[model samples]
Target: RTLPCSGRNLLPSTCGENRRRVVRALATREPNLRPGIPDLNVLRSGIAAVLSVALAWALRSDSLLWASPVSVVPQQWITEQRTISGVVVSVSDGDTFRLQNVGPFHPTQDRHHEQSFPVRLAGVDAPEISHFGNPAQPFSEEAKEWMKQELLGKSVAVHILGRDQYGRIVGSVRYTSGLFSHDLATELLRRGFATIYRGRGASYDGDLSNLEATEINAKAQGVGIWSLPDEELPAEYKRRTRARAF
Candidate 1:
């Protein structure tokens, strides 16, 4: 007779008892084996569940990473008006100086509380000083010395305007206890030690007209740097000197 599993009679009648015993064993185990085997539909459902959870977590992490940089973007464009009182520690040039004990200003940050910061005088560009074997532009020494006398060790009120590309705070400084309130940039321009920066994107906040007038008067009187024949602007002088180095 043919066996139900193999569809062919491979055993003779002498082995009939052995075949009957083997058939009975398989029949008894078949029910347990079917339950022990994994179902394809159940396996696919479990994998899908795990992938969905991982995808959700990844999207949340990506959103947080994208938001971090946007939150910390520097506020360079937002102009804030702040008045700070500090003593001039050093003068870098006519247009730049170091101020100490700067504090009590608006938007109080720990860094500005009692530290020294380099300040670049806004709305003016001073002549280039002779340093590092570079030739001094006209009136550079005079400009520096003038600022030294007027501001060194002197307490002044600084009108914080913005920041320059070199990361220096740009402001208008005036002596607080002098006989006459002296705006440092105007003073420099009046003496012809510096020039009004009239380049594109120059922001003096309505003081450009006044600064230009002062510069014109200085030029007419032939004072300081204006007295030199065909004096080069400080910016142009720096560029030409740097080019020569190459």
Candidate 2:
């Protein structure tokens, strides 16, 4: 019987295979062995290769570049079967907010950090940052800041709509009201903070939000967000997104 020469020929789990392959590859690359001078050229080339690999690993430890794509890492189950309730940790500006959801849900199954979900307001667009301070309007920053203040550190409820195109939970979010006076999005519109974002006809959600929008506008000529500069109109916001300007 012939002795195994490499890993391909070995049965399995041979610790010597790696060392054997490396030594064989080194020898194959330099067929002639100098008896006394130590084969400086081949030795130098081997050292250079080792140093290059070491350098790449060292750099990858600190930077994402040169790192292997983590495509093979198995994804864990995240969406579970319990309703979550918590104070909003932060509002990532209009349309998206984060919730803590302390007790009602436990992350015994999730592998992600910080149990926060991004929420999208179903029906509106408030003034964009670019809409501020021009002859067009004055409250763009104030609107954004107001949204932050209201949602952050306050109680809110989120209805999970599964995941969206941007990996956010496409859900309806409303502030916590002891009296259940209004949902968060409707109240935001009433206070002139957020505007309704109508969905495409095919995927339109319940008409409740649409009616809320009308009621909000009926009050005080669209007082808060309704009074934004016409340049920052809802239609323009849609175009800006479809056009991918921002």
Taking all chains together, each candidate's TM-score versus the true structure is 0.61, 0.50
RMSD of 1: 19.1
lDDT of 1 by residue, 1-246 (tens): 556444365543455688788767767864344757887777899999998997577434421111121122124322545555666778898789987643234222332313567888888999998886898887898999989998887677767677778777777777844468877788899999999876544567568888899999999999998998898999898778889888
Per-residue error (Å), model 2, residue 114: 4.0
The C-alpha stretches of model 1 lying farther than 4 A from their native spots are 1-79, 102-114, 199-201
Q: Name the regions of candidate 2 deviating beyond 4 angstroms.
A: 1-83, 104-113, 130-138, 177-181, 201-222, 228-231, 241-246
Model 2 residue 117 distance off true place after TM-score fit, in angstroms: 2.6
lDDT values for all models: 0.72, 0.53
Q: Give the TM-score of candidate 2.
A: 0.50
Task: Give lDDT for model 1.
Answer: 0.72
The positional error of residue 169 in candidate 1, measured at the CA in angstroms, is 0.3
lDDT accuracy of residue 75 in candidate 2: 19
On residues 1-246, what C-alpha lDDT tens digit does candidate 2 reach at each position? 334555665433454677567656766794567567677777999999999997677444321112121121111112431123455666665556765554333342441326555665655555555433323334556766777876776665554444657766555565644566455556566666655665562122455656465645645675765554553655565576657644
Candidate 2 weakest ten by summed lDDT: 68-77
Worst 10-residue stretch by lDDT in candidate 1? Answer: 62-71
